[model samples]
Target: MKSPIAIRRGAVAAVFIDLQEEHRQDQRYLVDGYEKILANVQRLQAAARASGVPLHHWAYIVDLGAQDRPFHPVEADGKSAFSDKDDPLTAICHEVAPADGEALRIKAEASAFRSGPAAGELKARGIEWLVVAGVWTEACIDATVRDAVASGFRVLLVKDACGSGSAAMHQTAILNLANRLYGGAVTDTDGACRLLSGESVTVWQVEGSVPLRFTYENAARLYAEL
Candidate 1:
């Protein structure tokens, strides 16, 4: 069974991860339903601002001359597949771009907390819950959600606000995270906005260990329930 979660206005904040032009504009990296994901993120941003929830935006940018990770994908031209810091594609999407005074953090790694002060900063501000939304659900989004939970923060994962290269990848990633997302909850854009507004909302939460034993046949059914 799912649980009801109440997010206090001042104790919760919104986090947007890698909502950049690279994911939307680049054909190689564009996610399925990219436009719909951005629309949902925009809604979350507006709700966060109206409800006084602090918003932190993060973008992934590879250093121009820095040594690439062993597993980092490279194109035939020997350039990194991801955008470099100087690349115009590194810019955040204009629709959900951070407003003035909202800090835009650049991260070198998939998990924002791995290379930045995000964890400490959020803790310093007394933020106990994070409303997380962004792209590449199986990569950066998955990594960030696990780190946030391990770092002792409850996450309100915005499902519809996130996307991946394909619908199957996105749903599978969400299912994997949901199985192990202890102390956190998985919600869609509507439920997340309500929680951001200090409303009590019913969200999907793990009740037991490995409750969702995902298989190919059951994937669609499980994702639909989410």
Candidate 2:
């Protein structure tokens, strides 16, 4: 296989999913390697903007009051601890907040396309491939990647730019994505940047080692020592 999967400028879009402030505040949902993920996301977005590739953001929003009849079927009413209206919580993390002209898609589930026009919008914009990054590697990231592939959009998942509550889950999700689910190449932020710049990187096939510096196990150990 080629080093990193090559993505042409016009055919690919950079997507950041569910990196909301709420997730950051909640230690349980905050994935390990969050700091690195945020930094990488910012780097990826900057590269995307400079290269003229479209940038898109997905935010999960739920209404707590309507527990009996929530706006989104999967989001049971009163189940969501935070609503999108919680400005601080719902706001995209400051490190990677969308800039002017970038579009934000509001979703109520793990898959952004399920409750929003993400699929249609991307199709309309002529996006043939996606470079996906963001929080909760095992949940939202996984869902969005699968959905994107199923919708006929090729995807290159940014491995280092996403995280999960635990290292095990994060690794598992990426393995499933590269091996079973999307069957696409996985790259880190730098790899994505190079690909977007029409360069090549080591094609990251699933392996035994984890490349991230601050893994969930490490983080848990450090926190316990605190």
Candidate 3:
């Protein structure tokens, strides 16, 4: 079968489920961080879009059958609390609505390729590289990286574009994954863009990872209408 093509600005996204009132006060809230999560993802989407990056090409992993979860979901304050109106990751995918020619993957598990159509879709598209960005970095991100690498795809984890239950969790996840899974291929949203397109990198570079200590200040202005 064919595989996903090699593209710097390929299918990427803030792969997470929408948080509803039920999401919190329950185990799900642990992964849903209300406005913080949405804001961060929106920023990521806007940044990617301004860069002439195709939102449709950005594959968002949603839990269509998530009666249960095996990942992390946190609040904006870095709290692992659920919320109300948690949007399904697929809604974001449909938001872009890729052309029939493009491909998208639906998953019910933490890892995008752990147990769903991601593997097959990726294979058929011959996807050699994936610029992954999303929330709950510790759980879903970790699992996705493990699976993607095992399946033979170069994984570029977008640090800033992803978050976790807390700062500690986020940082720890980045360190572990970069060292263990990606061998230091981890980068922030800006760094990911620079690496992918070799243009302007807005986020600070700390050992080639996110949680940046520096930022391009003019990053937004750099690509005002990108």
- Highest lDDT: which candidate? 1
TM-score versus the correct structure, for each prediction: 0.96, 0.80, 0.54
Model 1 accuracy (lDDT, Cα): 0.89
Ranking by lDDT: 1, 2, 3
Residue lDDT tens for model 1, 1-226: 5778798768898999999998877887888999999999999999999988889999988874685578777778666787766669989999999999999998888897775678998999899999999988999999999999989999888999999999899999999999998888998999998888888999999888989998999987897787
lDDT of each: 0.89, 0.73, 0.49
The per-residue C-alpha lDDT of model 1 at residue 210 equals: 82
Lowest summed lDDT across 10 adjacent residues in model 3 is found at 16-25
**Residue-pair clashes, model 1:** 0
Model 3: runs farther than 4 Å from truth?
1-40, 47-106, 198-226
Q: Per-residue lDDT for 64 in model 2? A: 50
lDDT of 3 by residue, 148-213 (tens): 888777665666556666656666666556655432255555555554453534332124333322
- The sequence of per-residue lDDT tens digits that candidate 2 reaches over residues 95-164 is 8988998878777678866555778878887888788998788788888888888888878888778888
Clashes of 3: 30
